[model samples]
Every structure is written in C-alpha cells, then in structure tokens.
Target: MATASETKATRRDFLYVATGAVGAVGVAGVAWPLIDQLNPDASVLALASIRFDIAPIVEGSSVTILWRGLPVFIRHRTEAEIEEARAVPMADLKDPQRDEDRVVEGHDQWLIMIANCTHLGCVPVGEAGDFDGWFCPCHGSHYDTSGRIRRGPAPANLVVPPYEFISDTVVQIG
Candidate 1:
C-alpha cells in the first residue's frame, strides 16, 4: 500500500525517465541522418582513374578518351606530321606558339589536348589534312595540328591537360 505522496513521487520519476528516453531517441533520429551524410556509402561505385593503351594508336592517328569527365585528345604524330606542326610559323597562327606550346617533356610527337573548342566548348573533329588540324563544324573554328587556334572565332588554343606515360604502351590523362 503506497501513500499518496509516494505515488506522486513515483509518477514524477517515471515521467522524467520517459521524457529522457524520448529526448534521446529524438536526438538519435536527427543525428543519424547527419552521421550518414558525413560518411560515404561503401556500395557506391567509385570513379576510378582511366588508363589508355597507346600502342594501338598508330602514328598519324588520334584517339579520344574521357578523362575526369572531359574529352581528351591523344594524337600520335608521324614524322611528317611533326614536321608540319613545326613548320607552321608562330606569326602565321592566330594563337602563336610560346614556350607553353609544348606540354610533354622530351616528347615532341605525342600531342595531348582537350578536344573541346576554346570558343563555345564544342568538340572539334579531327579532319587530318583538311586544314592539317581539327575542324569544328559547329562554328567553323579551325585549330592547327598542334591545337593552336588557326582560324575562326576560337579565342585561344585547345586546353592541354596534365598527362604522363605510365609505360611504353600506356598513357594516363587526368
């Protein structure tokens, strides 16, 4: 037989305990989403770096691959193509060749550039000898074989991304 005062005290204790439990659960529910947001899902597919085998790209041929979600152009130049690029005088080009014209160290034949046009971000199709370079059919922008702006509305040369030769047959573009 509990007294009235004892009954009230027990009820108050139980109420405090119930209130604390609900508060903890509510806090946990809110905190759970925040914790989940902070952690990356292990089941999600990771964006691994792509590697291109350059052996199949014969001299005078070009290959395009997606690198970091951008189209990257890898042009393997033949001796004649290299000569053609070198023969284009800087004064004749809309975007003249500076020391920055060359990207790779000690490799003059392998030209890597972003395939997007500098003007409107359109992908320029390589036309080989039509102009000895890329031709953007979108707006008639012409880029020389070295990716320099040769003609049209392109304000600058094609972008050159960082690249490295992993092996004789492999090139990594990032």
Candidate 2:
C-alpha cells in the first residue's frame, strides 16, 4: 500500500542504518587490539609493586629479590659500612651522590639498589668489589657501599628503585 517515493525513502534509510552498523563494527575490530595492547600483561602488572619485610635481614648482609625480571638488592648495612660510605668526599664519587641521599632519614642502615652492574647488566657479587659494595666479575666494575660507581668501566651508579617504608620493619618497592 505504500507509494513509490515512500518505498524509496524507506530503502534509503535502511541502507544508511546498515552501513553505519557495519562501519562501527569495522572500526571496533581495528580499535580493540590497539586498546588491549596498551594494557599491561599479567606478569608485568604483578611486578608493578612489591612489599618486603626487613626484620629478618641482619646487619652487614644482603638479600636479593626479583622485581620486573631483575634482581633487587636489599642490604642491612653495619654501622662501620655506613660510616665508611659517609666518610667518602663527594669529589671522589663518579656519580657524586651523598650517602645520606641514598638512604631514608630515620633508617640509614638499609641500602636498596638494583643488583645489575651498570656496565653490561651482569649481576654483581655483594661485598666483593674494591669499594666493598658490589663487584661485577664479568666486566670488573666496582660499586661503593652507597651503590655509587667507584672503579672500572661502569658509567653510572647502580639504579635505585622507587620505594617507601610501609612500617618500621616493612618497605614497598616499585
């Protein structure tokens, strides 16, 4: 019972609606993967932060923990080590960072640094370098007690990760 112009207009409206739906689907097909890729994978998301208990780490010893596929060193420095780090003049350092700057105000005994050697990503041996901090056996780089680069081929100091004390004996790192 519809007239000729009415039939043509209805067909045109249907075509427009159908075209819009298909275009939207096509756009979504292309955009979904890109949006999903921006999100972090499960393992990486898991490493976004880590909580550590410092109570069991005795003085003058270090513990290694995995964070974002890298080893992080948590050292409980002895009083002598703290004194030795503090005594070094700023001019002697390759990176020129003060010992107090590297540690928290109330808790100067805890030293936290990323465990890889800055020279070539090799793991450093704790308390073995010329500076009595960490030594990279692979390339002979030395780090001091404050994780400052002291000798050999490394261009910079060991990296310090973002961290905070959650409690007197607990620390959170990211």
Candidate 3:
C-alpha cells in the first residue's frame, strides 16, 4: 500500500486538523478579554463584601446602611423589643420564623435584615408598625421585630443577607 496519492491525502488531512486547532485557539485568546471585562469592576467588588462597626450604634436604636444597593437595617434591640419578639406565638405569624433562627447565636442583642419589604420591595419604616417592627406604607405590610410578616399582604419574612461577625464589634456582610 505504498501509494503516493494516499500519502498526500493523509498529509493534507493532518495539516487541516492542525490549522483548525490553531485557529480555534487564536479565536479563544481574542474572545477571553471581551468576556472577562463584562464582570464587575473593583468598585463593585468592594461593595460586595463590607465590614460594618456596630459599636457606634446605641441600644434601642438602629442604623441603615447600603449593601449591594440594598438598604440593610442594623438594630441594637432593647430588652423589651427582644422580649416582644420572643413572646409572640408561632401560630400568629403569617410567615412563621423563630426569633432565634433569624439571628446568629451568642449575638442576641444585634438584629440585621434587608430593609426592603417582602410585599413590593418598598422600604419599611422600622419600630413604628402595629407589632413595633416595620411597616411598609406602600402596601400596609406589617413585619414583627424578628422580621417575620405578622399581618397584611407580605408573603414572606424580610430577607436576611449572608453575614457574620468578623470581630466583637465588626460585622462582615455580603
């Protein structure tokens, strides 16, 4: 089977495959930067995870901060507020969640939640509702002190963003 034409054809096929592979690699190299640039830049990335100090926040008072373009409520709950949240029966809640379940253990005094109301994404006013939690003026949604929907139109509890205490007074939220 020592045919010159067959040998030429085999060589031609090998060249075609090699050319195709090289072309594919070239195309990938050109496209990579275009794809990677679409990702979030440094400023956006910096906002993705932030460390907040809770030391300045007074007991029975709360502060609101922006995280990933969402308003987040960081509350230093008073003893009465904590007691009120814990005393409510699970049966009375529209979206029943235990008070302890919403907060990290050993950090009972601090309560954090995304301030947007679950009903229509409206910012709820804190410590002013029927349950003394949060009330969405847009839809009359009432959230309890534990951020559980106690009444009105909301179907779920206020969202709890991913967060942890990095130090005694510093909290890292993402």
Residue-pair clashes, model 3: 0
Question: Weakest 10 consecutive residues, lDDT, candidate 2?
Answer: 2-11
Query: Which has the better lDDT: candidate 1, or candidate 2?
Result: 2
Clashing pairs for model 3 are none
Cα lDDT tens digits for candidate 2, 58-146? 88899999888889999999999999999999898888889998888898999999998988999999999788999999989989988
Candidate 3, 12-64: lDDT as tens digits: 89899999999999999999999999999999999998899999999989999
lDDT of 1 at 54: 84
Candidate 2 differs from the real structure by a C-alpha RMSD in angstroms, to one decimal, of: 5.2
Clashes of 1: 0
Residues 1-174 of candidate 1 have per-residue lDDT tens digits of 976653445788989999999999999999999998987555432323567898888888998987766788898877776677778877887878842355576667788888899999999989542568898889889877688888899998898887788887887775
Error of 2 at 17 (Å): 9.2
Index of the highest-TM-score prediction = 3
The residue ranges of model 2 lying beyond 4 angstroms of the native Cα positions read: 1-30
lDDT of 3: 0.92
For model 1, the local distance difference test gives 0.79
